[model samples]
Target: MPTPIQRVSERIAFAARTAFDRLPPEMVVSAFGVQYGHLSTAEGGDLFVTRLGWPMLDRLLPSQWYADGWYASHGSQLKGSTGNVYRVASRPAGGKSLDLVVKFSRMAQEVPLEVSTGFPDNVPPEVIANARFNSPMEEFGLVMELRGGGAAPELPRMLTQKPLAIYVPPETYQLWELGRSRSRFENHGHMLSRDQEHATKAIELDIRRMYVLVYGWIKGLDAEDAAEDAGLDAADLERLTVEVIAEMHERGFRVLDNKPKHFIVRPLRRGGGLLHREGALVYGLVDYELLQRTTEHQEAFWSRRRQIYRDLFRRRDEPSPASSATHLRPGRVFGVDYLYAETPDGGRVWTVGRNPGLFDYFLASRWHRTPRTKLSPRNEVYATRTRDGIDIVYRKSNVGVRPRADPFERRGRQIREHGYNSPFETVAIAEALRRKGIAATVPLAITRTGHHSGTARFLHDARRFRVHEPFRTPGAPAEPILIPDFDYYTLWASFGCSGQEAGATVDLETARARELLDDAEFKALAGQSRADLVALGIAGVPIANHEFLLSTDAAGRLERDARGKTRVALAMDALTAFEYQVLKEDRYQDLLRRISGQLGTLGVQKLDFSGNDVLVLLGLDGEFLAGPDGEISGTLCSFELMRGFEGLIGEPPEGVPGI
Candidate 1:
């Protein structure tokens, strides 16, 4: 990487001590744009310079790299922390140019609408979508444009605020430092007399001049944005801090190292009256190499920040005493943490948890019918928008419930991962059901084991019971039979819908239709649904197998008759033609037989190979029952049977056992 300085040898000499000393200053005097001048140095050190971008960036060419001023924060960036930030100007080119702090981690990036996961790097969108990081530094590069104005202070680490390190050229050791200032003068009674005169001097400056000039590590940045850069107001700044905490908790991150000095607040934007600085305010958490991936960061941050805030506020000389959670009120917020429940497919009933912010929301809500509840993003009308998508039980239901407990405290009581509480629990349940000669199966397990017996990520059912919510309405069903979501839980999601939302919708709708089949059309749909389910191999169900199917419809036609009266007609799609065929052809044999015969009758008939009716069947037999069988896998019963066993009365089987 060549420096912007002119003569190449001079550029190298500036970074050296010996051999290059003989070169003429003119040859060494490289003109690196306007701000950078070529010069020589002693030993070892870091170099900082700005330049225009390529065709030949060294020789400015037509490009989109026009930036007012951008800065680079020195040191390393951490996952979840607010800390000391270092800044210096970088060339105005397009590689992750953010005006605010950028986080680094394995955040799945999207190109247009395709889900692509990769490291943070500078490249065109199309190029970046397919990029990957080699190490931390490369993956964590952030270039933030400074906020407008100089009134607000930016967190050196966060706002590309640079540390003041005196660079003495090549091979020379650079010295960095820490500086302190007081607001005692301007904040009369606000600043503790750290030094009355010094504080007063700081206050004497124009209100705009009332700045705290601190000293520290890192170095240089001539970055600035003209119009949009303004500081945030004090109030808004505080809220931003809280929101930062919220994001950390929701993302399953824990801020390990935090100190007052580690925080850097920069004001690149204008002022926002008195509440907050004008432009967007950024709070960067620095020194995060010690971070852990637990959900405990909330407490750690609050405990540490409170003491720091308290000390800072008290130093202002205000006698008002206070604590944290000032923004949290009871009636305004509510939340729910899922406990444990069977999934849609009933595979692994995983036990997850609630993040800290949501925990706060749960504690703040008024008593609701559900045991627990919380305020979440409004778009959470479906799958949660958060990292864990932790659900808070707030809506009232048929289950009798009690008051919700505070999630912060409740998380302690939960099993990190519940054992038998998942869909896999069905293993035992299925065994028990099968022993009774009932046609039961573990279809989900089979679904997980692909047709070729491969592994699948959709191991758990749609509703994993990490946290199970009981029905809220007094007495309801004895068991909370969560609807199974075949699309997500089976070996399908990857090849199924686009995401959890679409997957959930399909499952819910199908489940509802299956549950509400007292009507004729629904009866047919339910029959097929059952058969389709069974053929998937969750045998031991009462529905008839696809092996035998019946079609039915309510009678009514536009036939011209003497009486000329007509009534509504009901129609049915044979359980076998669609349901049975789909399964026999697909891989769901357990599902095939289980859903047949369940269709409630209208005008019923049996179809032949050509799809013509060969016989009239009696209305459905009582719902099918699993017959006793040792080697068979699916239900062995009949729901709609040809009424006249009379037609084949002479053909008695030789193996008819005495029953």
Candidate 2:
């Protein structure tokens, strides 16, 4: 409805806004509410550009390359489906102009369910929908794998790929009416001829959206065209095609569409034959819409890779004296031993890098000799001494509980989806958090428990558990282990000052109130601790009073600052707490809403803070400077049940799971 000039002005403004940010902003707001404005196709579908792609594009193109300034002069349309392709001729600063192919993928594909399932009948509609939903990401994965040292099979080098943005057009009754009318009229003739049941579910169509990808343009012609120009016979072309297919499979990929057009062959030089001087033909494959590896293949490849990695680690570390033991195997590093044991009920145990003597003592007589503290109905905490005389805690992981009614049911469900983590996961997360400057208990070793004939029902999940293949014993059969239990060093050992003496530690709440009352500023904000607790409660986070432990020097008095003022303890029991006598009236919903909003602002989601999940550090003034916005500024000690956020590794390489 707007004039041409107005439309141009609008587009210019959009380009300016989007170009200002190096990577496109995730969302934008308009009269139609918030929408994804970045990384969309020319026809307004979803598109994604990867992190690696961004730097390459920036280096090769001008700053205004994404804007109308460069695009207007150098961008030309290329043939594609689901969305448009643009060949942008970009001239780098003082460099030659180069052509880059930018592909905008229609996010959804409507392939017949029959093709996906290989079944003519009884296919579920949801299967087709799910396939369409994952198609875009699947293609991205393939490109990423090739980029990350996977066999490329002479494919065009992918410069980078990323999700640009999601475009959801404003819903309108008119659009819905148009869709319904078209659906009915277009299928009318076919419906009249076919049976009602057959016609109803005859086709599966998805017109949802698209994503974007960028690749360095390959200089070549399609195999079909190149063969004709090069005077190659049908048999010669077929031989070349067969070679290409064999190479793709060798690299752990199976291309569903092996058409001649998808293969590109570079033109021979003048006076050169169709074949290279070395008698080899150079070609590349394209159009990876139906590319994937079978589940069995994936497991086998990863398992082999893991074994090679372990072998390398073993070779790198010096052989321990314990390696001489017949039943024991040398671990990946020195001072570590992999101890194997059989339970009384005929179950198996694989303990990682723990003292063999300590393992024997603990696993002896079904752990009956070890004393335990009942932390909760589901958790039993126990302590044991290693052969080296260092104490460690063994907490039983209650992985398979199906509670019918509980306040934490939602959180429990989320954790289950990621799998009930074993000691391996615990150690991996702890090490990762420590690297990120977050304080957490150290994981010493993992004990995998297998089910015996008389295993209890409560231990079913653990008994039937499969060890992460990477950590499994090499050459062992791929079988499920019993539940995995983790061992952790004591928290008090983390304290800097000498606090081993009795009565040298107190809860953080008591220490702060007792020591910081003299300072007016500290006294004024003393209620902040209570306020934080209220916020956490409103946010549906449950914590125990005993979790926060504060440690003092051997003098049994609060540590003093250089100015002689009392200093806060490092080992705090509770980050924040309130005295029962001064409890305030509950503002349940308001507090919950406020806490939820604050957590959302901090990008914390699907996280459970129950018990000792979070640790807060306090400054000399007795205040935790979590920032002016009261965002959570603390160490996340526990990662169990945390989801929807990046872990210490950030994004893993393609096909690799996060540790």
lDDT, candidates in the order shown: 0.25, 0.41
Candidate 2, residues 464-498, lDDT tens digits: the string is 14323334442345333223342221121122211
Q: Which one wins on lDDT?
A: 2
For 149-203, candidate 1 gives per-residue lDDT tens digits of: 1111233223323311112222211121111122322332222121122111111
Look at candidate 2 and tell me the lDDT of residue 119: 23
- Candidate 1 error regions (>4 Å): 1-254, 266-275, 278-282, 288-659
* Model 2 vs. true fold: TM: 0.35
TM-score of each: 0.20, 0.35
Residue 205's C-alpha lDDT in candidate 1?
18
